[model samples]
Target: MSARPAVRIVVVDDQEVVRAGFAALLDTQPDFTVVGTAADGGEAVLRCREQHPDVVLMDVRMPTMDGIEATRRIRAGADADAAPRILMLTTFDLDEHVYDALVAGAGGFLIKDVTAERLFDAVRVVAAGEALLAPSVTRRLIGEFTRLRPRPPAPELAELTPRETDVLRLVAEGLSNAEIAARLVVGEETVKTHVSRVLRRLGLRDRVQAVVVAYESGLVVPRSDVR
Candidate 1:
């Protein structure tokens, strides 16, 4: 058996010290490689195009090109298989726009003060092609936006099996695969298969988008009283 390849990473921040600290810390991990660093969003995209790393740690509020616009540009430009997973780093007060970052194609967002373990796990999770949606961040932020906007028609919601629909609702609720499997009295792999089917049927890029659909289609409501 062969060991998995190290997860290559690029850190993007306008603050030189912040970028260096992240790059230095991540480089110390055996399973991670800090391939490059950038001082702003524009430079980040250029580095990504050159390094083609597995994941990027992107700061949300940089000058010239904010992370949201950079994310939109990256997703727009990269070929499907070549797109690097992006994890947006944000301060708590800035999360109002973090939701926009997600919709713009960020794989996930992490609070800037997150523990080292959580940060590393977030990168690995996204690099594995799964969107990292925390219940605190993904659910609340998405639900808030969905509440402010009118529901969009998601005819594809009709395509999901009853079981798959149930799975997606649970996902939107921030349950992990194992937790969903336990709740539904099934195997974890079964839950994974159902999630994959839901993503395929809906043409979603990842779980984050699936969550967006669940909210926008009214599968889940922002307030507990509503649903």
Candidate 2:
């Protein structure tokens, strides 16, 4: 059988040291290839168009165009299924721009202090079209935003089975498949099935978008719900 292809990555950061460091470390991995690097969001967009990489590690802040705007433009130009996945990089887990990045189109984010292993894992996860919804960070940030923003109805949500809705709530709460299974007193595969159904029924591509829908639709709320 043919070996699986290496995941192509483009690292974008204003700092030369950071961009080079990520490229070097990721290149050392057998299944990862650093296809390119960029120092700002404009360059990020240009490189992404030029290389069509599997994933782009986008920095939240930059001089020419911010990551949020770049993410928006990239997503706008590509078919939803074909767009390259984006993993945002931020100095703080709660960086304000990150919330906007998620809304714009990032599949996940990494705090600047992330370990090499976690960073590599995040790239692989997003490249595989999985959502990197890190519980401690993602859920809390979503919750905070939910508390402040006005919830809009997501008409697609009305189509979910009650069980599917429950599963989505748990997912938005940042529970893993196993934890959700344990919480619902069902098998892990059952939880996975439910999660998958939720994604499909809602026309969502992955769990990250599901979480965004849960928040935007007010199906789940901060502090008072999902916990």
Candidate 3:
């Protein structure tokens, strides 16, 4: 396919090599366009406001402004829907503070050593209005948050019907729409409707937040005995 309309992107990293590498890689893709680059979260926020890229490959740690704060500011700013989705970059082996990034309104994350295909795929996923709610990733994030933040109350429980609660449990277990449909013995479209209703009832941004709520609200606990 002739170069599709570019998914405008901004590379935000404190390190020159990282910034250049990301920008160059993304620019090489047919559908991706490198709109700008920034060396810190502060500049990233400013550039985002100015350029309004479709996606932002944000580094977790940077001088002047870290990815967490920049993401928060970008999410909180006027015209947040115009704000690009933030995909945090970090080493997979590192203790990446992913929970903070997600709560800060980042759409997802990518490890620095990821392959070009993986990077592009991640960008596409976030840009397509999907959250990176991988089961293992969500589990790790919930485990970390549970150890740090106080157990938040399930304030929305009263709003959720017993059926909604069941749907949420399946969501926290990482069941996709089809899987949920199959397990619930309902049509896929019906499951989708249920998912939408669940989100609206709980006032969640997306499935990722639903997973976090399931854990933090003590609705779902880490399994002491895995099957």
Candidate 4:
């Protein structure tokens, strides 16, 4: 069998040491290739446009421009299939700007203190066209933000069928495809179909956006007891 192509990646941070450190660590993985590194969001954008990486590890805060704006700009006019998946890097798990990053099109945010293995897994997950929302920190981050600033349901949300709505709720609750299948007493493929339809109908990019819309639309309420 042919070898799977390496996942191209770009590491961006204002701190020189942190940028080099992440790039070096990611390079150690056979499946990951660090195509470029940048000191700020502006430079990050340039590198991404030039390298066409599959994933970008972007710092949340930086000079010239912040990661959120860079993420928005990167996704704004780019083709959906070609846009790089952005994983925001933050110092704290509950950074106030994290919600904004998600809204700006980041697949997810990673705390800078994450272990090497976790970092590798996160990059792989995002690269595979999946959102890294299974982590408890991510759940808490979304829940807290939604609780503090709840919005009315979007009109597009009404387009979802009852089954698709249920799937979205379960997804917002951080259930995996297998878990949602078991909960609904259906086959995994059925669950996947519902999830896909839900994304298409809602015009959402991925499960992370689905979770945000679920909370914002009141289809799923933020639980104070999210663990």
Off by over 4 Å in 3: 1-4, 77-82, 92-96, 223-227
Runs of candidate 4 with Cα error greater than 4 angstroms are none
Comparing 2 and 3 on lDDT, the stronger one: 2
TM-score of 3: 0.86
Candidate lDDT scores, in order, read 0.85, 0.85, 0.79, 0.89
C-alpha displacement of 63 in model 3, angstroms?
1.1
Name the regions of candidate 2 deviating beyond 4 angstroms: 176-205, 224-227
Q: Residue-wise lDDT of candidate 1 within 1-227, one digit each (tens)?
A: 99999999999999998889889888888999999999889998899889989998999999999988888888885654579999998877336678888878888888888889988888888888777875465677788878787577699999999999999999998788988999999999999999989989998767787888898899977764422
Clashing pairs in 4: none
Model 1 per-residue lDDT at 182: 94
lDDT of 2 by residue, 1-227 (tens): 99899999999999999999989999999999889999999999899899989999999999989999999887775765688899999998777688888878888899888999999888888888777886467777876776677567888888888889999998887777888999999999999899889978887666777887898788877664433
Best by TM-score: 4
Predicted structure 4: lDDT: 0.89
By summed lDDT, the worst window of 10 consecutive residues in model 4 runs over 218-227
Report the C-alpha displacement of residue 92, candidate 3, in angstroms.
Answer: 4.7
Candidate 3 residue-wise lDDT at 54: 88
Q: How do the residues 7-58 of candidate 3 rate in per-residue lDDT, one tens digit apiece?
A: 9899999999989998998989888889999999999989988998889999
Compute each candidate's TM-score over C-alphas. 0.88, 0.85, 0.86, 0.95
Q: Which consecutive 10 residues in model 1 have the weakest lDDT in total? A: 218-227
Looking at candidate 3, the ten consecutive residues that score lowest on lDDT are 90-99
